[model samples]
Target: MMLCNESRKEAAGLTPFLTPRKTIRLATWNIRTMYEAGRTAQVAKEMKHYNTCLLGLSETRWLQTGQLRLTTGETLFTKKSKIKLNIIQCYAPTNDTDDEKKDAFYQQLPAVLDKAGKKYMAILMGDFNAKIGADNTGYNEVMGTQGLGYINENGERFADLCSLNQLVIGGSIFPHKRIHKATWRSPDHVTENQIDHICISKKFRRAWKDVKVMRGTDISSDHHLLMTAVRLHLKKFKNTTNMRTRYNVSVLKTKEVRTAFHLSLSNRFQPLQDQIENNDTNIETQWKLEARKEKKVVLNTSRTRAAKAKAQEDYTATDKEVKKNIRKDKRDHINNLAKQAEEAAGQGNLR
Candidate 1:
């Protein structure tokens, strides 16, 4: 939380590069509790300015109940190769009552992947907060020989669910690289580690190469944001991928499902104005006609609603881009300082 009277600067860092095959690259970070207003502004700057196609942000500390809002707001998700494809940011409760929280996480997670359709290839990465179960990754502690290692107990379960569902764990951390382990560096230094994990599905693996982590840049926060990049497998025919698969029209798709209701309303009301004008003996039926008009009015209102929604998204993107450029300028300034210091060190030695 930041004070209303306080001043803060955005400070988000990211490394960007073009892939060999022209696929887009994406990265993930937990970013601690995003309730820190100052940091969230920075996260938006890095996420957007880097042109990240996918960002799995967790511990956003943003309660759906409106405890906070991302600098980019709820509608950052848009169409057009999903110019903005951000997923749910979660902070699964770690208390004693977290037993079935994994169930809740899975319940929510699959829907996103499903809505993402078959070919979009999501870059799902975040602070899973999952501890490796019992003596596996160099730590040797057991809860009862059964190895009930838990932190993201349910969060870990969800990560496994992602794997079982065919997602791939990317980076030096996980079943793939499985080296240079130990990401969660606790002050008390408990060996139970690797809570911050980066994962993606098989549909997105071949795109991820040379995945690595940022060793040390001690700012603050209990967990270091796991850093990894993936060159999104850009298909040759990418246009008709996510937006229009025949499978999209199903028992699911609540958003598109509303179209049926909308069309019905439109059919009933739009011609009513002419119907009333053409009929002379229908005055007694005014209530019925007005009811039909109401339905059409409601449906027609959606046209304006969609326009505003798109406009808002455009505005948020513009603001985010401006702020990100400013942060990049600041980072360049710091890099210049380090170079000057190194040059001075070299000159002093020459003397």
Candidate 2:
């Protein structure tokens, strides 16, 4: 019931320490059943021998779904990340299973795919109990012409599911001998079929370099080990030095700091007063100038006391307005930075 990853030391867990751009071998096998004594150890030994980074298992026959760590240092049921590789391990109902159950299985699968999202490279693989044969007539987009046997009822359903999700059947795409293509052999060892499969999302179809049945592997099971070579490169880390600085604007809430900040602004304005009196500038520049030039012009040209007094009043109002605008701009900038920081945190980019 639980999908597992079997690997060597350092590679024993799932995606925690996977090297970027490295070729990882992923596989799926219906070990028929994993109830026998030391069956897990036997599978892990063959997995290490094949250098498989992650292996999806079917028919584990475990009573519950949860993490299980073996004494051999192998962990089961973990996740992957970044330009993430989402692997869904399945052990579908057989062809004889009721139609309602098969329909439910196919319906629930899309929900899982939706949870994974379209942005990731998803690999859906396992013992599907379906046989999509060599004829890629109607299901040309999702399969190839190199499959093992003729299409069955389960095959039609499987092919339709792959086409709906835009998944490419990896086992059917490459030219391999019938022995390499077949994933399951009958108990009598007389009949063989490629029921087990590994499928990759069509968008990342190129990442799947190759897929074939590893018949040499021995696990005392009827199913052969179906392995795929996948090239995965996680997105590189961004440089922290180039990130924007988050200023401490909380100090502005203190009266002393506000007064000091205003005092500093007033002192800085003293030097620009003369320049403003001599030049015509933009709106922002005029605001910074505090209408000093307009005041000076009125004083020099107007002879009436009433006109001079009115001009003086206008200049005082303009100065207050400029200070108010400056305060508003500062508050807006701080709020914008806080919003950005919240968004970054949500995206798991605290830096």
Candidate 3:
């Protein structure tokens, strides 16, 4: 388990991208069957331990495809990806399985691939039960020569599907030790094969960082956990809450604005000033009333400025014009400062 964890941590540093919009650590494991007691918790525990966001489970032994929310706070999507990502998790028929069953699986496979069109990024991974072998031969585009075992009938079908869909077999591209590449082992521990696999769209081939099987995971299954790190580009959403709408107090430096503000303040207080003259009402009370009215006027002016700032902020946020405006404003401020400094120097005001 310690070895498994150290290797999983090493995968994090293997990412070569300077900036990834979003990173997803995904694992595909054929857990044989999820019918055993505490099986769900055990799987969830391992998932959380490795800090994996998404997991593709196979041979779940469930009757139909459906989703479930685990008590551990992870939502299992047994079928789909909500975002533009198309994730297809499947369990292919073994070599010994009936030919009719295999034919049905291959037939349905193309239909699913068609639905997850080439326009979007798709991840097709599961216990394929096919060994592509180290001999890539004419299949160099879809797979690599680093594969294990010899090519079989199932391998031919898988390679063809990948070629047609523009999907690259991720596991075959990276060279790893045989122990790290092998996905399944026999009871005697001598027999091992790289049957399970992960494949990604060829268009986003650079996004695939690494692919290897985690043999040290504590899951009680014949198949080891196959994982891959992929960098996915995501759309960023701006948060508008708590955006500062405070008026640029420096605007008061403009003579015209200062004059306009003073005029507005006088106009607002004129009525209060007149009321004070006409009141036989207590002088102190009149003064308090005038103060309250003055405070209201100031508050109203501040609110008007705030509304204008907020409107500008909203417009810039939606249009993404904030950076441009800020650059322009910076240039203007620098020019003004330089002009003021030149004038001061002309006057010999060194201080």
Compare the candidates by lDDT and give the number of the best one.
2
Please provide, for model 1 over 29-147, each residue's C-alpha lDDT reduced to its tens digit, 9 standing for 90 to 100.
65566566466566555555555554555565554531233445412221123223323344444435555765676677777767756554555556666654433332211111112
lDDT tens digits by residue: candidate 3, 138-241: 88999998899898989888898899889999889998999999999998989999999999998888888899888778778999999998886546788879
Error of 1 at 144 (Å): 26
RMSD to native, candidate 2: 18.0
TM-score of 2: 0.61
Q: Write the per-residue lDDT of candidate 2 for residues 1-351, one digit (tens) a residue.
A: 122444433333335423445777889988877789888889878878888877898888777654567776566643332213478889899999999999999999888887878787888999999999999998899999999889998999999999999999998899998999999999999999999999998988877779988999998899999999988555569877866789899999999999999988885675367446734333574556656667667767877999888887877777777777667666765676689679879999654
Candidate 2: 10-residue stretch with minimal lDDT: 1-10
Ranking, lDDT, top scorer first = 2, 3, 1
* Clash number for each model: 2, 0, 0
- Candidate 2: count of backbone clashes, pairs at least 3 residues apart or interchain: 0
The segments of candidate 1 whose C-alpha lies over 4 angstroms from its true place after superposition are 1-25, 40-56, 63-89, 132-156, 171-180, 190-192, 233-351
RMSD (Å) of each candidate, 1 decimal = 35.6, 18.0, 23.5
As for candidate 3, its clashing pairs are none
Locate the minimum summed-lDDT window of 10 residues in model 3.
1-10
- Alpha-carbon lDDT, every model: 0.49, 0.80, 0.77
Score residue 62 of candidate 3 by CA lDDT: 77
